[model samples]
Target chain A: MNVAPNNQIPNSQGLVKGMHEQEVEIAPGTLFDAEEMVINMGPQHPSTHGVLRVILKLDGETVRDLDCDIGYLHRGVEKIAEHDTYAMITPYWDRLDYVAAVSNDLCYVGGVEKLLGVEVPRRAEYLRVILTELQRIASHLLWLGTHAIDIGAVTVLLYAFREREEILKIFEDFIGARLTAHAFRIGGLWWDAYPEFDKRVRDFLKILPGRIDEYETLLNANRIWLSRTVGIGILPADEAINLSLTGPVLRGSGVNYDLRKAQPYSAYPEFDFEIPLGENGDTYDRYLVRMAEIRQSIRIIEQALDGLPEGPVMAKVPKVIKPPVGEVYFSIEAPKGEIGVYLVSDGTTKPYRMRIRPPAFINLQSLRRLSIGHLVADVVALIGTIDIVLGEVDR
Target chain B: MSDEEKVTPPDPSGDQPQQSETSGEKSPQSAKTEASADKPAPPRAAPSDKPSPPKAAPAKKPSITSEIAGDPFIDKIKETFGLAITEAVQTLGQQILRVNRDRYLELCGFLHDNETARFDMCTDLTASHWPERSGQEFEVVLLLYSTPNNRRIRIKAPLADGEACPSVSGIWAGANWMERETFDMFGIKFDGHPDLRRILLPEDWPGHPLRKEYPIEYRDNEWTDKHIEYREVDYDTSLIDVKYGERK
Candidate 1:
């Protein structure tokens, strides 16, 4: 067994050595270092979902170790949360996970409301359910499109975007903005839904089920799709729970835990649906779970639209919002996973401290375990399965 | 463990002895909140391993002061590990326990393993700074949840400036990055974290930006000329120097 010298060790000629292909003739006659090759795979990559940079140590085509180098997109959002008043932080929540602004807004304002002991109207709660379910579908659509593209399924991207555009239109019709729509207040909604909000959302629900079926027909049983995702990233049931992963990733590992279902908040109890769980906990299982959740999201939205209540959306409150001194932890089931707002108010308009328990940021920690023994190419699929948004990951 | 562990006991001299006796102590503000009578409670996870509660009603009634009288976890921990719990009280429909930083891990393990208080998830761990509080200025708050009972607990341990906050990663692997992030932002050291380094900020960044003494203005950014060249970008360095003199 002839092992090449370590990179730190010098050959007879005193030329520096590093891990490289054996054919490379760096010096007169020095073999390449025996160390595993390390590849930095983002900060500017299409498959990375956002600006997430992963430094992967590889042995041939297999990934030996994975170290995620996030914070490239860190805007110090938590630090910013300390400075802004409770009302001002609404817009900032939209920036954490840009795809699911409604969910983010609900978690933050919901926590603040809990601290202040404000009661949201039943009608307002129903409206929140309707909007957030649609947001979940939209967020999952973006994830599916990019995830499929990562696995070499380009056609799914076009099909996913088709449905996603209509959801965005519904969002714009009422919320007045598309991507980072800062559309929530602490006590309740800033304004009632636009008249067209119901009709547009209903129209979207009518067509979304068929669109999802079309997506399933294209890739559900396809040989190539199965080969790429079926058993690629296998995080067992126990490891999944131990890692504190929430949402689809944890559910895919056979955990029947969803915050919306387990702890009903904001009219979630009014809707009827199933909590989808997968047994294998592989990439394919995660895909199946998210696909099932899209159908469930549609189910929730339809119920909310039909049973829409009539009342004031915004609650009566004082001009200056001041919550008593205490801390509250509010967790909601966002599309990707559980997004929690840990708020500590110091009896002032501005929050003393606010911490967001971002699902993507924590979920990314399990990537090292999932990627260790897999191929270099499979790292992309693992990342896709985790469904991380770098804005949340590096926040 | 230090011999001078000032684990504040449930002071008999304090105003806590009897819930019935405190009916007269209810303030005017609490009376107003009580008028709603049906203050909507925050959701609680239902028992029976069911994902969602079958019942349509919220978990607890809006007025949460009643349940604080018979709080089980706080009572149990006080009886079991008397000195470990520095302070325990009910707040906002949950138990807030201030545990000794030296015994934080042991207490966390007991909570994780104990039958009734099986807090399965270490949801969040971070620190907050209060410069005005002289002796115990920094407080590390850890939130835990028990999936079985559907209960949540907040453990806060206060420390002086340079004291070490013991790592809980051995008990919950997920606490790794959280502890690192806390250390990164607040400059609180975790005694035994495997890889204790900055998670969200650059490793060589100067001061803990979350500390009160650290200036919040943009002009105070400490990046040097070499870094600007290394991360080549065409931008006005003067913009960073403009103090936030105007309304923020």
Candidate 2:
């Protein structure tokens, strides 16, 4: 059998396309010194988090150039939003980031409310904070589990999912769904807390800190975990911001910008919490940052619950939602990063154009920058660290 | 629509003008003039003629509120790029500037590097199609934020149907995928984009799915016929209809 030339490698579809067609250049010494091979990592690989196909150009074991081919989970969400009414679109937002459905719902709901200028009641505002903070913790826990599992620590997945199940049970009790809980309305929450909602939340919160500590005790000092994670995929602060990275990914690079603080939305201003920053922007520092964020989320949720006000849950919003002829860009700090909704309403029942600034989509762009010099195995670590959801990225 | 019962106080009383249909035309405020300039041709702003279908009771509630106001930041932008900025308004406390399409890249570079408004982050880049606006139909919106200044400004550039807007991916690297997605959805071109191709849809996809002319439901397309192999499984829809009928 004849071997293909260096430039004309087969792609994911088995089509013989030139690697140069993908706009990646072969490094100077890589062409003459060693034989170069192009390989596809995913679209079916479990460690990719979803159907993310990364075409990596390899020189021996090192990655020379990489390009991501996404959109496998593309559902044309923005196109669909143009046809649906304002109230009907909230469910679709839940499907964007299935793990952090509550936060996605809050971002979309807040954007619509901002366009309409409807002020949510104090009780609803407080409840929104509590639910979103709980969602942030839940999302971080899932990331912790899956990221660890991807890097060869199978025990963490079981431990992390155990705690995640408790949070999902709370979600099921509150909103009647485990995964995609559309727990918010345009103006406020659909239903107020159940009778034992407070007790259930408090019980979960009580056990959360201890559970987090147990995960730390397992992985913090483990030699194998440290060998695989620490000092891997280090992204500096300036590059992270230039790439428009957000959430914990930006925080891990020591950038002190959190939407909850930089531009406070919802009832976050009423509650007190700290924005955690990492000194080194590596896989381990990102891990520490997310763990610290989980604790801070607990603090915010506890404060919101203690100061939960007494009033009507829903605001005085019109039944047929029609925002004025204007455009509003509303964003909230979601679990993976900053999820924004750019809404344009032409004074109609349906949106003229609805664009989602998905954080994972932007953060995933930095994978090329982070994984270029590392081994092929580190590409998995980098993807896990970025924490992308293909549904949101491709939407 | 309770403007009086706002959680955040309604935009300092003196900065905003009294509510009226002709407020944008009547007021001499630079912001109002900019708002009025935006109201002329675009179908999005010309919502007055075909009034929205009447609502039940809140029809009397004011639909148009004058939130446009001049700000010091906007003044600095206006001073730097005089005619490049065609219109400027602050709606719902969002500072929006409509720039001339030819000078868009220059304006973006200025915004990214200027001291007053260092919009280092390009939050998003997407286009809205208005087929009714014949000459200039596509509106490209760029949402930018300053990490150092903790402020955001939105820049909108109007482009013709097949016109190419200058890409800002060189200034902000994250715009590479966003521009590709825009190209994939609306079929808008971004000049000087390093890799200007489809991001979401397949390379062989049929049409720009987000264009105004495209239908929402799925139809037979060339890409599907080529890629997806069909195994004809007779999943009965009549059974589903019968179950739903029984439940009803």
Candidate 3:
């Protein structure tokens, strides 16, 4: 609601600026012409999810141009990674995409394991798959709730949070932290499945489908929700690929590429699940795609838990962890997109360069393409649709 | 040198099944212990006949070759763009190609348009600063993924301290911000980046923090003082001065 920059404009102000500004190449006798106005949307607005400041050049209500001004939350995470040891960096990875900390942890640890060529235990891989899938579901639920509230459906937010709280409870019981849980170690997990881990996940899975059904019942056919999102912010398949958009946003554009399906890692090859595709590439389609992904996540967790392997959870990693001089790129399908870690080791305990290929950071690039012609109100919905976390974007 | 020596001697050769995991741990440990030795460790005692040394010691560079004959993809790329690829190396199942900085754009265009390798997504673009390496102080790394082929390759271009590297943002739209981030962190210039301003740091911030020589805990007190307004506290008179605030 707070507009930080100057919003007031006079007719003479445009003429004063036109003298110094570059001449526009306009077709002769063009019927459509409008003066452009620039305004700042947010570095503080709640609907932006976090400090995502978008400079919007507006031609009336329609967005003429959009530029995102990020780095409000930059903590130099990559710089921090250089100083921290491989094992010490796991907790920092959790802070990259705080919403899907488990998935981020998986990517970093898996990258380190791949660099070391250490074979993780079967039990640990299965447990990792279970926890990350749960994280995907939790992340999608938070997105759905916040996205719905951004549009106007207050009821769905309540229902979504109710279910999300349950997942957080399970995470608390297992990993001792709900949000930024450093759920993984360098070689494998720090701990095996707790006594109630199986039962807790099974119970959640049993009720998740019904809860998903309730969400659909609330929003699928509702006129208000459909009107706000149905045909708004369309990104074509080819354009999405060119922009390197991933996760549900890319899937919503009908691109049939998911890292789990494309490049299977951990115990993902063992369990079977489908990557739901959206045809229209609209905000509504993206919404449907993410909702379907939650259901698929439940299916994956059920499979992983049902066939849980029994072995040593932690692999025999050296106390003084050091990797070879070569560099390795390891990626996994995070809830947001393809979260990858490109680690360069100079045969030392600390990484020479630790570059986290943040999915939200890349996926957020499509915001300009998606929100160009949309109205000011729809920009909020588009930002929500992208599902960006400023922590990862600014890191 | 000595680090490799210490890690190699501890490899349990008798244990075959767990050797892969244990050898991985020991070889790196041994390498660290024998790091000060004269000669580099010879591939870590060959516990399971691993291909390369356990770790890349500072003394020994990873062996690289320009001739990679077997793989059809590398062969085709080499055939199309002769001499552009300076060296090719396969380390731990990851294919890395070092390309000529002058011909970098053309190679990227070919890779994106080529039917066999339709690398639709420019997965990531970043740079690392190696101050110890003379002349080529920064290496810009690109991780490209061919969605159809489901293959990933790394293209690295080495540059002198302040030299400009050609940008790939023209090929992949996602590379725009990535190039900006790389420039912001490593002070490496991208020749044709659309908008190459600092993306992760303040516009007025000084020095690239990701450079190897930059300290881990650097504080920009100058910028903070310029932008942030604080109540002027006189240590001579203020009760909260360090002299009075010190605990006995």
Best by TM-score: 2
Q: If you score just chain A, what TM-score does every candidate get?
A: 0.92, 0.93, 0.92
Compose the digit string of candidate 3's lDDT tens values, residues A76-176: 88877776778888898889899899999999999999888789999999999999999999999999999999999999899999999999999998899
lDDT of 1: 0.79
In lDDT terms, how accurate is model 3? 0.83
Q: Which residue runs of candidate 2 sit more than 4 Å off their true CA positions?
A: A1-33, B1-70, B229-248
What is the Å distance of residue B97 in model 3 from its true position? 0.9
Q: Which stretches of candidate 3 lie over 4 Å from their true place?
A: A1-33, B1-67, B231-248
Weakest 10 consecutive residues of candidate 3 chain A by summed lDDT: A1-10
Candidate 1 deviant stretches above 4 angstroms: A1-35, B1-68, B220-222, B229-248
Candidate 3, B-chain TM: 0.66
Reference-based lDDT, residue A108, model 3? 92
- Candidate 2, after superposition: displacement of residue A307 in Å? 1.2
Interface root mean square deviation per prediction? 7.9, 7.8, 9.0
**TM-scores of all predicted structures:** 0.83, 0.85, 0.84
Give fnat of each prediction, in order: 0.36, 0.67, 0.60
Q: Number of clashing residue pairs in every model? A: 1, 0, 18
Instruction: Score chain B of candidate 1 by TM-score.
Output: 0.64
Error of 3 at A20 (Å): 15
